[model samples]
Target: MASSEQHYILPRPEFDKPTKVLIVISPYYKAIADDLLSGARAELDAAGASHETVEVPGALEIPAAISIAYRQSNFDGFVALGCVVRGETTHYETVCNDSSRAITLLGLEGASIGNGILTVENLLQAEVRANPDKQNKGAGAAAAALHLIALSRKWGRSGREIGFQPEGIQIAGKAEGPTTA
Candidate 1:
């Protein structure tokens, strides 16, 4: 397949308030992981955002690590970085799909997360995508998280209310009573 020559870059988000981010990386491929981490850190630094990095065993663990950090830490956003190169076994598909789904679910739950996990057919493809001077998927993921965090702050709430509540717009906590005509 042919790749697009045009590169569309979005304006980097600027945060009014201080932003803290957590980066969860799976260091299965040390060299590739290092490149991804380097790119992500550079983006976070440029945005004037402080960040913490943690390593997981594999791509499947990246999401769980973020989830744990999300609950126990006070990070404003998260970046998940990893590389999953396809293997002869079906484990490749499982890792890619599960990790992605977990990240999406966390995002839907109001967590600002950027998925930097690369699913590639070979190590060469992964290297190209993870390279800082190449695709720089790592930096892209960090930017995604920052944008979401900015949007969340702009909206004043992280999540939306689903279904009608008996009292007020808040979804959390119990409603006092059901009032209907």
Candidate 2:
């Protein structure tokens, strides 16, 4: 068994500009979800970031909800919170893996998401990890999203523009060919 050790807790990052974050949570396990939301909200508050919360049916819906908000809303980042306790059937594995993979894919696509879905063996484990005083994974996830947002702001537009003349950049919908300088 992996030792449950508290290694280090990073301080909440500071933002130069005001930031808004969306928190998407699955309240299937009502008590656990509430605890997770509390931790995440506390972290966002401490960092001086404003946030809005939305509830879904289960862990699998977290990534989907975040994706929708990412496209439709102006939020700077997102925090996904949920608890998945392992069951006897293979459904446990499916939920855990699919939710995690979707969250990762969204993050890769510049969604700036922090995944707080807990994959544990039992309810006790979930409670311990979700507890604000204990592992507090929800807060950790919020911090991760905040860090990514700060990094994104620090280094804007990575200079990877494509389909343009090196010198004479083509204007959109002006002409079929590149505009002359």
In terms of lDDT, the best-performing candidate is 1
Error of 2 at 135 (Å): 1.1
Clashing residue pairs found in predicted model 2: none
> Could you tell me which residue pairs clash in candidate 1?
none
**Candidate 1 segments whose C-alpha is farther than 4 A from its true place:** 1-4, 157-181
List the candidate 2 regions with Cα displacement exceeding 4 Å.
1-4, 158-181
lDDT for each residue of candidate 2 in 55-108, tens digit (9 for 90 to 100): 999999999999999988999999999999998899999999999999999988
Please name the candidate that would achieve the greatest TM-score relative to the true structure.
2
Return the TM-score for each candidate structure. Answer: 0.85, 0.86
The C-alpha local distance difference test score for the whole of candidate 2 amounts to 0.89
Per-model lDDT? 0.91, 0.89
- Please give the lDDT score for candidate 1: 0.91
